[model samples]
Target chain A: MWRGVTGTARMCCLESLTYSACTRTIWSWRSTIREFVTLNVGRFKMPAKEVSS
Target chain B: MNRKQTSISTCFSYERSLEDLFPLISSAGFTHVSLGAKEPHSSYLSVSRRGDLLQLLHDANLRMDSIHGIRLDLPGALSSLTATAEAAAFLDVPVIVVHASSFDFDPSEFDERLEVVLNTCEALAPVAEDTGVRFALENVLPGPATELVRSALERLPSEHFGFCYDSSHDQIGGPKPFTLLDVLGTRLLALHLSDRIRDHVDHVVPGEGFIDWEKLCEEIRHSAYAGPVSLEVLMNFSGFKDQVEFLRQACRQAERLYPLVFGENAAGL
Candidate 1:
């Protein structure tokens, strides 16, 4: 029973690590995509458009 | 010789009319102001109202040294240019600082877009010259906009065309900010002094952010620019007094560092 408990604990720890790694990767990509959009496409609209509209 | 005068942008408090803000600026010991060509306060669309604004400035004992030109894309750009030039002429302002471009074109369309911008500048250059005003194209970031302006300056070769270097934009604009002063040299007509923290374009007070004002002062002193360092800081009413004092101190620090960085003769001390 002790051995089984130790095995389950190890599995839970690995799952937690994987979850955090995935979260970090997603956040990194989110920031990159935001910057890419801003630099490559966001500035096309004129400031006047926002003012006039 | 007297030290180069310091000016502040009206963008600091756009909600406040010239009558309300000019006194505050004068009280802060700023004799010169750069009028922002936007809504509610100093609108280029309401160029006819410039007479009243001029009266307010005159009453406040402040001078409108320059204008931050309106940003409009083609079809409307030429008309806006005319209005801005007219306003500048009416106010007797010498420089009308404008953005090179506001659009984000694809890398594939870079050359074509640049050609369009250059042609537009070419068409507007003569208008600026006729009105006794200089078109100082301000640098923006995340692309080759500055280089494009440089090319436009080369192709046009007009005395009316010049550059307005923005420190905050340059901080995020890939290249080192001071290097731009070296590149533009005598073509530099005006400055938009602000600070940025890392990739964020904060426009915070000079020393509060990551900008090295000492080094930038040295670069400006070494360069051919002798104009007022105008602050294009973001608006914050509660801390307005602190911001004014901060800019005053920054200008004083630049003045003190000028001789140290460039020596007596170069600094004209």
Candidate 2:
């Protein structure tokens, strides 16, 4: 299961990889980016056991 | 020159029985009379009972003009006003004359005491007003007599409240060469008329002392106040006959100047 997941992610990265070194510039794409992170995690400890009589 | 107006106050000639003194005072031609409601330094001739006093004034055909209560400096000063009003109402008197409380007249102390006096008047004015009697504060303390009276009038601005302008007290404890006409001209409700000599020692006849009775009458007329000018001289020391003579003379002087000094129909003058 881990091998297949890692192989697909490596193929996607190899397919999109590119290097530009020519003096002529390619079409330059400008993009504005905004970022936010949401988190939801909770934990509650058990109430102490009642003392036995 | 205005004719002087005079009335009589029963002090020295006041005896155990008003019946004993009524004839003498009425015979002396006194149309108005004042009763010393309190005991003088020492005198069994007390008019402590109010009913007897009322009957006496009614029988004599004399108007009970004022009831003089002394010892303002004593504890319970307000009680004295109450007692005085009680006696005055019993006698159907329209006015009551009181002296400045002999308590320390220090500006600060006077301010404190005056507050108490004003509070006293606040409680007493309605009582007097209801009975149709007025409380006239007379000046005797050694301060600006007019200012003292002014402070009092300012404190209690009621018609039932006024001043009994005492010339003798003014000459003695108050400002020298005192003329109430200049200071409390209109607020003068009555006159505690007596002559003063050398620091309030002798209650002499009107003209006997340095006080200008002529000027006093002139001011009273000018002020347009028609209150009684009750002569408050002691008869015991002067001899009843001499006192009567002085009183008669005062009346004569008053009548001679009444029309001129006081307008015609001087109802209470």
Candidate 3:
């Protein structure tokens, strides 16, 4: 996914990328990046089957 | 030189009754307060209400430092602004904090609005002189308000007109942060010291958010404002439901800030 995106958005699109180097470079924007990830992933979670039946 | 005084805006008491605000601040250890256009203080905006206003302040054992005049009621703010000066005089408040325009205004109408503000203030010059109250136009946001403030300061006389620097607004609303202090160093008569967060969450306690208090303290210390560190802080979003506790926290932060700005003496010599 990061192969296409660029800049902070590219850096923000990863799952295993809480690296110190990334944090150091993007210190001012890491919180927003984290929130973006949290919201995007949280929005697509699937419900358990038969839970309401 | 003396220790810088501390005062909080009455916006924190919007939920409480008008009469209770004075005593509340006094009990919370705040000796002075800046009146706001909050619901509690809405009806008390006149010279006719002077007697009641005085009795309230007198009974509370607190004095008014300033009044946060109309921030957005436009097209007819002349009367309110004039009455605010009258009220300030009656209360012996030295300054009246005002906005350049409403919080949300059209960018296209900048000049028109600016002209309106200037004309209204031009009309208030006589009232300001008569009441001996200085109208301090506060910096609201970075764009037009900033420009308006600069123009107003340049055009108006420093005797009856001045500038107010709000810390949160300076931090968030800017072409660049904290440049107004350097740009216009004169007539800094009032302050709205508060903190700000990224999502436009402002008026939080001084230390609760991301404002650099030490830097701000140093800035003001080097400036010409030798008056109260008047905090235009609010409590609705500060997580403190108890107003007294909120005031205490603000006062404690202010105590720490005073030394940073003025050293151990509480005033720069």
Tell me, by TM-score, which candidate is best.
3
Tens-digit lDDT track of model 1 for A1-53: 99999999999999999999999999999999989888978566444211100
Per-residue lDDT of candidate 3, residues B1-269 (tens digit)? 44345778887667676587777777766667877755235465755677887888899877788887775237668887787788788789889888877654567877787777778878889998899999888776667767877886788888888888887777773224566887765678888888775445778888888887777777787787866767878775686768778888887776677677656665522
TM-score of chain A, every prediction, order shown: 0.72, 0.33, 0.29
lDDT comparing candidate 3 with the true structure: 0.73
lDDT by residue for model 1 (B158-202), tens: 488888878877777333657777878678777787666555435
* Model 3 TM-score (2 dp): 0.77
- Candidate 3 regions exceeding 4 Å error are A1-53, B1-4, B39-42, B71-73, B173-176, B267-269
Q: Cα lDDT for residue B155, model 2?
A: 68
Global local distance difference test of model 1: 0.69
Worst 10 residues of 2 chain B by lDDT: B37-46
State the C-alpha lDDT per candidate: 0.69, 0.61, 0.73
DockQ of 1: 0.03
How good is model 2 by TM-score? 0.69
RMSD of 3: 14.7
Tens digits of per-residue lDDT, candidate 2, B162-264, equal: 8777666566543355555566667777776766555434455565566666776677767636656667665432322565575666565445545645656
In each prediction, how many residue pairs overlap at the backbone (N, C-alpha, C within less than 3 A)? 0, 6, 0
Clashes of 3: 0
